[model samples]
Target: MGLVVSHLSIDCTDPNALAGWWAEVLGWERAWDEDPDDDEVGIRAADRSAEWLFLKVPEAKAVKNRLHPDLRPPDGSDQATELARLLALGATPVDIGQGPEVLWHVLADPEGNEFCLLLRTPAQVRADGD
Candidate 1:
């Protein structure tokens, strides 16, 4: 049998708070049935791609993230629009030496975790059967 991913986990200083922020950003809901002050929190996608598991850790992020999620705009939306909305949700632009040569916008979540807001390519749109 092939291996399957149960969830994507993130280590943070505050699990509940970070989960809340991501939930708002991704339109996901809390999947954990724990107290508001729990050291671990979960956020799940409506389509069930995979849930995000956030666990509280004592250490802070000190370097660039090796693995980051790249988000594509929904069928009806564009990158610029989504980027603006994410900015309103506390995402900040991060310069990680990806200058003008790159097409993706590098942004960091509230916890300084780097993620990319990718430009939707024709392939993705076509694959969506648009």
Candidate 2:
């Protein structure tokens, strides 16, 4: 069988708060429930085509995320716009070993999850030294 990505799960200190932060960042909406459980919260893409889940963990975040999500704007759009938007959503800038020549900017979520903003499109990611 082949594998396909379904959803991404993140562990955080506050599920509701992080979920809300992501919702604003992605322009998604939190799914409705009478009372969201203490351990989990979720946000669905505004069109309902994708979902992201956040789960509460007892320990503090201690290291960089080994895996990170890369976000890009549609073709013909510049990365500057996307960067500004993300910063407005509460993402903080991070150095993360990237040099000035790097094509992506490393950033941390409100809860310190490391993610990147890529200058290239998915179709162009196979090149070297990206």
For lDDT, the strongest prediction is 1
lDDT of 1 by residue, 1-130 (tens): 9999999999999998899999998889889675767988999998888799999999999999999999888777888999999999999999999997787899999999999988885568688897
- Pick out the ten consecutive residues of candidate 2 with the lowest summed lDDT: 121-130
For residues 26-129, could you state the per-residue lDDT of candidate 2 as single tens digits?
77898755245668887898787788888899987899898888887646566788899889888899988887899888999988999888887544554444
lDDT of 2 at 53: 84
Candidate 2's C-alpha runs over 4 A off are: 34-37, 120-130
Pairs that collide, model 2: none
Score every model by TM-score.
0.90, 0.80
Residue clash pairs of candidate 1: none
Deviation in angstroms for 12 in model 1?
0.2
TM-score of 2: 0.80
lDDT at 8 for candidate 2? 83
